[model samples]
Target: MTSPPPDAFANPQKLRRGLSRIWHATGYSLQGLRAGWGETAFRQEALAAIVLVPLAVYVGRDWVQIALLAGSVVLVMIVELLNTAIEAAIDRIGPERHELSGRAKDMGSAAVLLALLLAVGIWTAAIVQRFAA
Candidate 1:
């Protein structure tokens, strides 16, 4: 009997040490970011982040506060990227509409929404505490 093909997933472990792995990983991350940028919703969120992240540093009083503010915004971006990835994978499964696919997409969207809500809540609390209280 013929041996099965090597697992594509196993290739990461085969990667050599030093600058090459870092270079390849960085390239893959950039590619993912580019793919995410192609989606309109991701583009809008990224644009918002470009503004909000800088504003976070200014608004926050201390390192902890700044971290909270900036981290929340970053969390939103991370969730958005993950959601986009999930949607893309679902789309790759097939063009036909299926309940599971719809559910998966909807769930991914909900995750993004929840992340946004968390970020908003954190920002609001921090702003009010710093200024109002």
Candidate 2:
């Protein structure tokens, strides 16, 4: 028996189908987070944000500062979601101790750290300016 031609794998239609498959898989991620972390620290932090949002509105006094605060919160959540995706993908590849897998997870974690730092800086500046005024 002869193997299939390599060009078949490289076809543009096939690549498009693969991208669609990945897009559909994102629903699984949303479900996982809703059933897992959404019930724990994620829920608590989200609740805290909800509570603080009104107070921020009352005290924000400027549109730019409000946008900065909102954008910073969103950035943290976006980084966290991407980090979770990386960790999940690595585990799905293999539940074993491999150097590459560790590195991938660590790199994802580093991205989250940077996002957190950005959020801290934005919040600190906004709050200081708001209170000092």
Candidate 3:
């Protein structure tokens, strides 16, 4: 049997230390954000977040309401990011189409859909509570 190829994460000791680790982690996160931003869906969701997050604050009467509204938006972004990562990993595995790969991607997409629906429901409930009541 053959061994796996070497990569940056091969050695645990090579990891950064202290503040350097934090700095590198932050850079990596920014890189991920940039990569996600390049995706059309992520860009659209991000734009929605930019609008909705502040609107949450404006529409919510209390801190709890504001947190619920804003948290739902963040949850969607988190789910989308995870979904993107899943698709990227599946793509990196191979170009050949496989049933499992398609299923994995579909499941990831479903997760994003659920998250988005939850966000919409949360926002609608909050809005109705604040205005319709």
Candidate 4:
């Protein structure tokens, strides 16, 4: 008989704790980012983040504003990563079309859209606050 599939939740990573776990986790996170870099949407957002984060300093009037501005940009990238992850997982399941798969992909896309809108609103407010009399 063929071997059964390994348990998903209880794997070797669970045994790690403290600094050792963090060190490995950080490496895994970087690897994920490298994978994310391959996606066009993620690459574009990263490029935008490169410009917007520095621009946040100029547009923000105070520390709070700067933090909000920078945080908003980061939020977009985070959401994009999550959306890409969702799409990747769905695609991995199979090439065949399924209702749930379409719904999940759509929801993931909607999440990215919402994040972008939020970032835009925050940046717009910050810009107006900095420039308006």
lDDT of each: 0.88, 0.72, 0.90, 0.91
Model 2 ranges off by over 4 Å:
1-41
- Residues 8-83 of candidate 4 have per-residue lDDT tens digits of 3568786667999899999999999999999999999999999999999999989999999999989989999999
Each prediction's TM-score against the native?
Answer: 0.86, 0.68, 0.89, 0.90
TM-score sort, best first:
4, 3, 1, 2
Q: Where is model 4 more than 4 Å wrong at Cα? A: 1-10
Worst 10 residues of 1 by lDDT: 8-17
Candidate 3 lDDT, 1-133, residue by residue in tens = 6443455367653455699878888998999999999999999989998999999999999999999999999899989999999999999999999999999999999999999899889988888888897
Instruction: Output the better candidate (1/2) by lDDT.
Output: 1
Top TM-score model: 4
Native-referenced Cα lDDT, model 3: 0.90
Model 2, 5-91: lDDT tens per residue?
567577544333466857756876678767546535456556656765665665566887777777777676767777777887898
